[model samples]
Target: MLEPEMVAFVERTKSLYPSDRAVSTVVEQRAMYERLAAAFTPPLPDGVRTHDAPFTSPDGHTFMLRLYAPFERERSSGTVLYFHGGGFVVGSLASHDLITARIAADTGLCVIAVDYRLAPEHPAPAAHDDCLAVTRAALDGRLPFGPLPASLQLAGDSAGATLAASVAMRLRDEGVKGVRGLALVYPMLGVEPQSPARETEADAPMLTLADVRRYSALYWGDQAGNEADGADSGMRASVSARVAWTIPLEASRYDGLPPTLAIGVEHDPLRDDARLFAERIRAAGGQAHAPVGKGLVHGSWRALATSPGVQWMHGEVCRFLSDRAAE
Candidate 1:
C-alpha cells in the first residue's frame, strides 16, 4: 500500500507525464522528461554551490561535469562520481542537480555529475565508456578539477546505476583500487524473465515494465524484435560478455565490489534488480546493503521533499557515503 504522500507524488507525476499522451519520438520523450525534471527541481539547498567544467574523455569526446561543493567546507571527505537516470536516453546534469546538491550538502563531499551522451544517438557502450573514463580520471586525480580527495565513490540511479555497478566491476577486474562505496537507487540492472517484481509491479506508477523494455531497446539499438520483447535479442546474446558494461547483471562475477547500498523501491519493477545484485555480491564474500523503500515507486527520488520514505532513503544514502568516506 502506498503512503498518502507517495500517492500524491504519483498523482502529481502523472499530471506532468500523462500515460495517455503518446511520445512517439525520442525528442518528444526527452523534452517531456526535461519538463518533468524542471517542475520538480527546487532551488539548490542553502549550503551548496555548483559549477560546470568541461571534461575530455579518453576518446577525445568533450562533455560537461557539474561539481557540487558544500559551502565553507575546509576539506571534503571524498568525491562522488554521479550518473543520472533517464533510462540512458533523456536525463542530464540539470535534471539531477538537486539530488547531487543535497548529497554534497548533507554528506560534506564533492559530488560530480556526469553529462554522458544519450542513446538512439550514442547507443550502448557510449554512455558506459564515458562514465568509465570519468571514474578512471577521478581515481587517478587526472580530471581538470585538480587534486581531489583520495577517497572516491560511484553513485547513480536507474540506467546510471547500471553504469556505476559495471564500472565498479570493471575496475575490480583490472585490480584498480580507491573506489570506497557504491550507491544505487532503483537501478535497472537487467531483464531477467523470472524476476518477481517484473511481473508483479509491471504497471507500477511512474515507470511501467513496458517503458523499461522500450528504453532497453533504444539504448542497445536492438531492433531485432518489437519493443515488447525487451532486451532478449540475438545481438544482446552475441555480446553477453561485453554487454555487462550496459547490463551489470550480465557480469559473471560480483566479487571485489566496494561496500554497496542498493535501494529498491517496493512498487518498482526494477526492485528485484537491486535485491538480486546485493545477494550476488554477498554470495561472493563482499558487503552489500539492499533496502526496500516500503511505499515508494520508481523515480521517487524526485519526491525527497515531501515523502517520508524518500527522505529515509536519502538519509540511508547519506549515511552510506559518510561512513565509507570516513573509512
Candidate 2:
C-alpha cells in the first residue's frame, strides 16, 4: 500500500517518464531520465555551494567530480564520496545535485559526487574503476580540492550504491584505511529471481524488475560471459571473478567492512538487497543498520520535498554521516 504522498510522487514521476513505455535508445532514455530528475530537484539549500572538477583515472579516462560544501563548516567534519544512480546508464552529477547538496548542508560535511563513465560505451568495471580511483585519490589527499578530512565515508544510491559498496570491500581487501562508514540508498546489490521483493514487487513503480535486468545487461555487457542474462552458472562464476567488484553481494565475505547504513524502500524490487546485505554484514560481526522506508519506492530520495517518508530517510542518512564520520 502506497502512502498518499508516495502515490503522488510515483504518478508525477510517471508523467515525466512513463514506466510502461516501450524500449527506447539509451540517448532517449537518458533525456527522459534527466527531465524526471529536473522536475523533482529542489532549489539548492542555503549556504551550500557546489563546484565541478575533472578527475582522470589511472587508466586515463577523465570524468567530473562535483563538490558540495557548507559555507561555514569545519574541515574536521570529514567528507562523503557520493555516486549517483541511473542503473549505470542514465544518471549524471547534475541529475543528483539536489540530493548531494542537501546531504552537504544537513550533515555539515563536504560531499564529492562522482560522474563515473556510463555503460554500453564503457561497460562493467569501468564505472567501478573510476569510483575506486576517486576513493584512492581522496584517501591520499590528491583530489584537486584541498586535503580531505581524516574521516571519510562512501555513499551512493542505486547502481552508484553498488559501486560504493564494491569500493569499500576492495579497500578492505587492500588493507587501506581512512574510510569511516558506508551509506547506501535503495541499492541494487544483486539479482536473485527468488528474492522476496523481486517476486512480490516485480512490477514495482519507478523501477521494475524488468528494468533491473535490462540495466544490468547493459552494465555487464559481453564480459559477463554466458551469465550475462543472469540465468546460468557461468554468470555466478564470473561474479566470483572480475565481476564481483561491480556486484557487492557477490563478494565471498562481508567481514571487516565499515559501519553501514543500507536504506531500502518498501515498494522497490531491490528492497531485499539492502536487508540481506546488512544481515550478512552482521553475521560476519560487522555493524550495519538496515532501515526500510515504508510506503516508499525506488528513487524516492528525490521526493524529499513532498514525501514524509523520504524526509525521514534523509534525516537518518544525515545522522549516519554525522555520527560515523566523527568516529
**lDDT top scorer:** 2
Please give the CA lDDT of all the candidate structures.
0.87, 0.88
For model 1, what is the C-alpha lDDT against the true structure? 0.87
Give the candidate number with the greatest TM-score: 2
What TM-score does each of the candidates earn? Answer: 0.93, 0.94
What lDDT tens digits, residue by residue, belong to model 1 across residues 1-327? 987899999999888887853365778878788888899999988888888999999799899999898775458888999999998889899888879989998999999999999988987778889999999999888887766777999999999998999899889989999899999999988844227999999988988888888788778754222234455666555555445556678678889999999999999889999999999999999999999999999999999999999999999999999999999
Candidate 1: clashing pairs of residues: none
lDDT of 2 by residue, 47-118 (tens): 898888999988898999999988765654889999999999999998999899999988889999999999
Residue 299 CA error for candidate 1 (Å)? 0.4
